[model samples]
Target chain A: MKKDRHFYWRLFSSTFTLSAFTFGGGYVIVPLMQKRFVKELKWIEEDEMLDLVAIGQSAPGPIAINTSILVGYRMAGIPGALLTVTGTVLPPLIVITIISYFYIAFRDNHLVKALFKGMQAGVAAVIVDVVIEMAARIIRNRRLLAIIVMALSFIAAVLLKINIVIILLFCGILGAYTTLRSKHDARSSPDSGKDESCAEGSGTGGSAGKKEGSD
Target chain B: MIYLQLFWSFFLVGLFSFGGGYASLPLIQEQVLKINSWLTPAEFMDILTISQMTPGPIAINASTFVGTKVAGLPGAVIATAGCVTPSCIIVLTLAVLYYRFKGLDMVQGIIKGLRPAVVALIASAGYSILLTVLFDSDDYTFRLSDLDFIAAGLFAVSLFLLRKFKLNPIYAMLAAGIVGMVIYGFLPSF
Candidate 1:
């Protein structure tokens, strides 16, 4: 009992510290969680970590949140899961609370105003990095089909202002058709759609690795 | 009314927020800014800025900040909880059916389709941010033009430094913050 308790505490602390400082939400948390969970604590193996990334991405919610819950739950079951989520969320809750207060006060301050101007630019760059990185990943590694679908969706949402929900549903059907068409193609082996990335803005997680492992 | 708003904003965002955190923004903007008028367009824009700068999902951050804004301390807790609760329930349900539908072709296709859709959603939100926060088209007033160019350059240079140099994002953000502070001291943002 004591051993388990200590284990849970360590996980809580480690995950808490990690989540606290992780700026940029889901994608940023990837390597950080990899270091702690895969390398330092030896909690999850590398391949499993990748699999978890895929799983967590597909599951729902932010990748970090889902990952925390899975790691926490695996470590100590329900209690462990609760502890992990708490650990991960607590620091942000505290820090953001304070930041929220000061941000409210400082929103109009010249210093903050200047700071956000730069920060906003940084945020855009991060998004650009994500899009570029994914484009390279898919273009070099995946299919031309993925690019076409992405462009179509962009037109649908940006040009149309069609509620994202409707676009998602409509495009979702089209996406499935592509998946089905590719599935039985003789040249394509199994696992072609297994390594998707949710954190990097793709909602699914199986395509990249699945394709790669076939070779 | 404020308390009611806290519940409503969260409930609505939580109800519709699918795929991931950024996916929540459009729904949130509609509820908090357009539908209810709880926050002005400027204040709503500020909330987004703060959300990006801080930790956690943007959805969670908005819930906490807006909740706090509308109703104070209790509002923060309640709103955050509300935002997360739906996901918890849904994910738990998802966990049960996870294996049964694991290899379904349709699911894979939906996911594939979602990528483009998700990208579009993000692009749209980014556009909305630009419209609300960056430019004033009617008068053509450059609200923060000087800082805008500097920030864009900073972001581009930092990305180069980050990928080319293999430096960490923390270092980049900190360096940018320091740069902002330096610019604060030197140039008059007035």
Candidate 2:
């Protein structure tokens, strides 16, 4: 029981410190989490960490929180999940709370306004980089369907001004339909397994490979 | 009632915030700025800036900031809870299903489909922010002469640094802020 308590405390503290220190976003926390959990602590294997990250990325919500939940659950089930999330969220909640108290004074400051104005441009630039990088990966895969979907969705959102929720739902249903149809086709063929693996590889393998290369 | 509204708004943000932090911008923008008018575009941009500079996830930070602005400490707690609730529920359920099924093809396909759309959402969000930064207007009707050349220049340089040199975004933002302080803050005539 004492050992279990220690383990839980470590889990909470690890996530707490990580969440407290890391900046930039969820992606920035990935390698650190891997280093801490997979390398330092040896809590999770390397590949398991990768799979957890993949799942975290694919699911809705913040990748950092999703990842913390997965790691926590894998470590100690629901209680672990709760502890890790609280740890993960507490840092920002505290920091932002303190900042919020000073926000009114900050807002009226001329220098602060100027600073945020500049930071706004930087933020926009970073988002553009993200778009370019993501789009390039899809285009690099040479998947015609992926390319078309990318273009069409961009058009729908920018030109037609459609709600993003509608766009995501439409694409998700379309994706499932196409995948099911392709599976049906493969099932009737002689080499079904190979085809399915190939499709899966092309869909996710690109990002996974890039992540490895970066590491 | 306001607390409930804050929770529900952030809950929806938590539920549909796929792709990552940048992708969630549009959804949060729609909820806070468009629907509820809780924040102006400039304030929204500041929230994004603060989120980037702070620790933890952007969604969480943004929620806390917005919530506090809307309803103080209790509001911040409730809004943050709302943002995290979907993540906990969805991730825990997925964790169970993943261990049981190993790999689900339908989930993979849905993710595959969501990728491109996520890119689109991020791009659209960036486009709007870019407009606000450069033209000082979120609307599309700004004249060419209305463009802020200094901001445009800073954006281009920052993009170049991020892509070519792989500079950390936090540093880029800091550099931009210092530059803005010197130029816009000190020299109003230039």
Maximum-lDDT candidate: 2
Clashing pairs in 2: none
Where is model 2 chain B poorest over a 10-residue stretch in terms of lDDT?
A: B95-104
**Which regions in candidate 2 have their CA more than 4 angstroms from the true location?**
A1-3, A195-215
| True-vs-predicted CA distance for residue A118, candidate 1, Å | 3.6
What digit string (tens of lDDT, one per residue) describes model 1 on residues B110-142?
A: 666666556556656655555443342211134
Q: Give lDDT for model 2.
A: 0.85
Instruction: Give residue B55's error in model 1 in angstroms.
Output: 3.2
Cα lDDT of model 2 by residue, B3-23, tens digit = 999999999999888877787
TM-score of each: 0.73, 0.91
Q: What lDDT score belongs to each candidate, Candidate 1 first?
A: 0.63, 0.85
> Model 1 segments beyond 4 Å from truth?
A1-4, A34-49, A135-145, A177-215, B1-31, B34-53, B97-107, B131-189
Best-matching candidate per DockQ? 2
The interface root-mean-square deviation of each model, in the order shown, is: 5.2, 4.0
